[model samples]
Target: MTPNPATEPRRFLEHLYNAAVRRALPLHNTAAFLPPPPKGRTIVLGAGKAGGSMAQAVEALWPADAPLEGLVVTRYHHIPPRPERLKSRIEIVEAAHPVPDAAGLAAAQRILAMAHGLTKDDLVLCLISGGGSALLTLPAEGLTLEDKQQINKQLLNSGANISEMNCVRKHLSRIKGGRLAAACAPAKVVTLTISDVPGDDPSIIASGPTVPDATSCAEAIAILQRYGIAVPGAIMSLLEQGALETPKPGDEIFTGHEVHMIATPQQSLEAAAQEARAAGIEAYILSDEMEGESREVGKVHAALARAAAHRGQPFAKPCVILSGGETTVTIRKQPEGTPRGRGGRAGEFCLGLAQALQGQGGVWALAADTDGIDGVEDNAGAFVAPETLSRALSLGMKIDKYLDRNDAYGYFRQLDDLVITGPTHTNVNDFRAMLVL
Candidate 1:
């Protein structure tokens, strides 16, 4: 028997989302990049949303006889369940994300210590992905953890792009921006990364802990100054004196190191596009490197989707428009004694899309983070239907007011539209889809 036609659109959107995620799973993408057993012990060091899964994949694929031991850090509650028969050799730990904590500091210290005294025959396999910057945190000399945390909060709330934020993180860290690779000198380093940043710039992914950094300390200082974030006097002096510089592209420490992009936002978007075309709908991919303010990006997407839905220009009816990449949200200052809004880029984008859509018929949309968590929130994202605005109006929920408060979660929760897929264990940044029929 065939499924009902009325529910096909929603199901197709979900299928596309799943396809995008499946393409990024470590289990599916790690085997090809696995290096052969080295002359000495093989150590794995990693951090990100996909760290646990990447570790497990390495454990499953590596030769059972050769020695394999290491550690990886991931966001809290993101670790996947180990297989029943697979004995764990790699230690998987939990840490804070989008904000560093004591756990991350300890983990970073341990990882650095482990990299010390490695021989040329030893191998270091680094599994990197999105969110590693926060998961593996070690403050540079003279900078306290509290200071780093404050800067992180400020950058996140300042609407800085990922590149800008990471530029600052790389300079202020003791382990990021190829410092980890430098510590493993004499030992070959192999990095298997999942791209979550715009342009898939390896140096920007998790601040490129295992790759050479092309950004400079001077650039980082400029970003901080442009954003009006104050730096300590000592740190400012270090930056001005070029003492906080990261390893450049030709640094000797990266002599035997290599990096492989295992998964990317563009690949995931193409996966979703394949699913759309298989379902007999024309698929259009706008871009996989989109960046900017989340709400503003949503409004722009809404305009494009509306043009197709209303006038059938650029794209025809019965089509799905897809896009990927990371977007930022700058938290607004709340009034005195008012509670801060809850939601991340995905939900916020949905709010903007719903508002701009204006209840146009035959249009449905979904915006979600591929990692299954949007910002610090539990839900991956939210969905929008043609009646979203009208339903909210009926429930006395003002879209503009909620948007002003940056309360996408509150607005969508009341409508029962939040997408709650717990811990996808992989991240390729944001996945957005619009269906017009």
Candidate 2:
């Protein structure tokens, strides 16, 4: 017989997070996922917030006889506490994220150099995960790291979606798209990724270093133009002339390349739903492909949760609504002369939920990033209890004004309700759960 789930709601949430974290552990999944060691030198190279943990995973699985040596770059503070067994072989380098820094630039150059002139006998194992697009910073010729930094900041604030943003990145990069894979010609490359993108397309993940390039220079230019991003004319001309050619599909450069998604957002959401079932709560995953403006999606979620809380239209009460996928914020719409708010999708979703709930007193919810960071803020996400609106009103906080400034993080922080987990060493996008009891 199954035991009763006596844990409180917050505890249950933690249990779900722990379960998801467990599935990500390198010790658990490394053996079966391990690739064969190369006949020659086996070099490791990668980037992303989860790069550190991924490197450790590979080291743990690799035979001691194999020649394993290389470096991985991860977001600052995202590295795991390494065990004695794997720490010495794989070097974990720290880099600035969501923006480029000198260290990241240096790391990118080094990783590029590491792939130089290898025979088919040599092997290159890449541990890629979300944040790699930024963590693996390689500026195009004549472009400074600052230029990349400025553009990256603009892209984040722009309403551009992941694909659009990555398209621009691929064009302006020396290592992204298929450039990195091209650098390691004749040397077989295998990439193991933990996907944070909605569709889990490897070419979209970290801009597909070893994968083919379906997006072209023109597409990148159009994406930049659609968002009103103005780059130098020289850069524009280079793209227009197809000077930046990423390796295309069937480019012989990728014949020996292999890519695999080791984990994904959908998988994480499924883990949460399974836990809900054990608690006797019927769980329905709304969609794993959710995207669009964060606040707007939040409002939509609020309506659904409210309906379930009141008339049980789309779903009955006592059912948990779950979803996964990244939601974006378009800061270009913020009110005039107002600083954008300090939160991400998770917090914004809660704001919309709390506003819609309006003290309804029956629904509870949690939204968070699997990587343990939401947006550009320090918090992963936030939780909304049944009395959230009541508590906010008592504290004299205006949800609409905070929402207007795009300051969802600040609002949640004031209430001491922000979820901060620092780096979970994994990314599968966002995880959301709404329970109506």
Compared with the true structure, all predictions reach lDDT values of 0.92, 0.83
Task: After superposing candidate 1 on the true structure, give the runs of residues whose Cα lies further than 4 Å from its correct spot.
Answer: 1-8
Model 1, span 1-437: residue lDDT tens? 22222476566677788899999999999999998999898999999999999999999999889999999999999999999988799999999998999999999999999999999999999999999999999999999999999999999899899999999999999999999999998899999999999899999999999999999989999999999888799999999899999999998888867899999999999998887887778899999999888999989988988999879988998888999888999888889999889999999999999999899888889999999998899899999999999999999999998898899999999999998899999999999999888
Local accuracy of candidate 2 as per-residue lDDT tens digits, 1-437: 33333436655665666566556655565566667786798889999988988888888778877789998999999888888755479788999988889999999999999999789899998888889999898988878888899899899989788989999999999999989889988898988888888899999888887788889999998898998897878888999999986888888889967887888777777887787788788888998889988777877888888888779879998888888777888774655776756777788878877887776656777888888888777888998887777677789988888877778888888888898888888888888888776
| Range of the 10 consecutive residues with the lowest summed lDDT in candidate 1 | 1-10
Q: Could you tell me which residue pairs clash in candidate 1?
A: none
What TM-score does each of the candidates earn? 0.98, 0.95
**lDDT accuracy of residue 126 in candidate 1:** 97
